[model samples]
Target: MKPELLAALNAERAARRACVVVTRLADGSQRLVREDELVREPMARDTLAAPLAEALRTGRSAAIEHEGEKLFLNVHAPPVKLVATGAVHISQAMQPMARELGLDMVVIDPRGAFATPERFPSVTLLAEWPDEALARMPLDRYTAFVALTHDPKIDDPALHAALRSACFYVGALGSRKTHAKRRERLAASGFAEADIDRIRAPIGLNIGAVSPAEIALSILGEIVAALRAERVAAKAALVP
Candidate 1:
């Protein structure tokens, strides 16, 4: 890697932005493709465009033959993170599963009674309001935000932040009726219909989950689905 290219790639990684280093094996030529530059960059607009986009989206490196020459694509995607609004029972159950899935988990709740260290010993527990805690964390495109607390005061602010940012998944725990009310509140607070639609209310896949553990499983399943949905679709498109 060239010094300047290495510096630029390091900068992107520090910013937690998705980037790819493409190397042409035949002649040892190399170039960097950044997510923000994918659309406008000339070099990325040819046959390499699709693979570069896929590498950024799926965070998978690949060696492929392009124009009779071998090219290697090294993907540098930010690690996926799970940020929950409340340290409730469901959040407790989610801790283990999130870790097992390799997701960096964070629980934020202001209630002293629930946000105890004993309750979340293995997780990054922030015993503070979601807005304040989230402000310190980088809520980027690789993040999955969940508002598990039913309280609007707690969940709404986090939802607003997630919607305003580029979180990959934004979910909330509530019934349809409860979500309806929440939608009304968000709309009244100046959120567009499309922005509100991004939130997966009545969160988790519909598997008739009853217990906290079961609900946590369902939510994690849904999060995984959201994370891979685009890649899955892209694969299906190539099946023909």
Candidate 2:
């Protein structure tokens, strides 16, 4: 890698943007394809883009046979981010679990008492309003946003942003009745029915999770399941 390429790669990493390093197995030549540029950048003949896009979407590096040459698509997706729009007990339990799964976690809360380093300890705490905090986060396809606060003032705004963006997963903590009210509120706020449905309410799998820790596990499980399902769907699109 050249110094300039190294710098470019580092900058992309810092920004949490996706890119792919394509290496030709024949001569060992390599090139970088940023997600933003992939649409416009031309590739060598036989190097179809569907596979590369799929790899980046799934964050999986793989070797593909392109016109008899083995070209390795080394995907460099941004770190998966978990932005919890609350500093509640569930967020605390989720913090350690997210870290264990290699997710970059952030806890957001406008309440000073809750959003503190001492209380949450060892995680990034954003003690600002969800609208302000989410505006700063680069919510993308690799990002996951969850509304654990259950307070519309905070969770609603954060959920709106997640729905508007390409964040792969958006979930909220609430019962069916609570989510119905939430849907009404979102509809009144100008979100279409389809858009509002993107939020997985009563979040996590229905595994009878009662305690905060178990609820956290269920939420994480749901998020992972969604991610895996998305990966499968993306790959399935390439099949003839």
Candidate 3:
């Protein structure tokens, strides 16, 4: 309700941070906990301190008692990180697909010709070799790596990098024979057979695609399937 507190809240929101507001209750208890980190308490300030402290510590919004009034607080969290590797023709098609799926996509390629905005207008383009480029790119739980380059020199290093990171999906574009060779190469490079299996090589579903665009569609479809499968597995793990 105070102008200074309101300004502070606005500033935090502008910085993209979650905040919780706390309000006190009349019975020296906390009353309302709102999603936007705003809490209202009718209790005294001192009575509200403990609940507010707990909410802040747990990064949650809670109601607390302040002089017997209830107050509420809001909490903010960072957005998810999403990045895509390999900026080939398939990538041009895949970028829009990813955007449609609400992913923050980025394109990485060593060839300037392939990594231009003209080719990938909706994605962040990084024209560096995957080994060097992925070194700087942030890969996390929500990140997905797709290797469409089809060249072992490019795809192998990128695949290796993706496997080493916490990325949720890692795939390589190739046919069955090509994927066999890829697995051999990775094994030769000291990766375990199990690690090599992490790649969804022959990358897409067996959808009988002949064109680049159709292939991209199949690949993205597989990615979505993999994501859904992971979600389902996670839920199953929590069911018990």
Which candidate leads in TM-score? 2
Write candidate 2's Cα lDDT for 14-76 as tens digits. 888888888888998888788877577465332467888788766889999987889998888
Q: What residue runs in model 3 are displaced by over 4 Å at the alpha carbon?
A: 1-82, 230-240
Among these predictions, the greatest lDDT belongs to: 1
lDDT pick, better of 1 and 3: 1
lDDT of 3 by residue, 132-232 (tens): 87787656555677887778877788888888887767887777999988888888889988787888877788899888889888878877777678456
Could you tell me the C-alpha RMSD of candidate 1 in Å? 3.1
| lDDT-superior candidate, 2 or 3 | 2
Ranking of all candidate structures by their lDDT, best first: 1, 2, 3
Model 1 regions lying over 4 Å from their true place: 1-14, 26-33, 37-51, 234-240
In model 2, where do residues sit more than 4 Å from their true spots?
41-48, 230-240
Quantify all predictions' global Cα lDDT against the true fold. Answer: 0.91, 0.87, 0.69
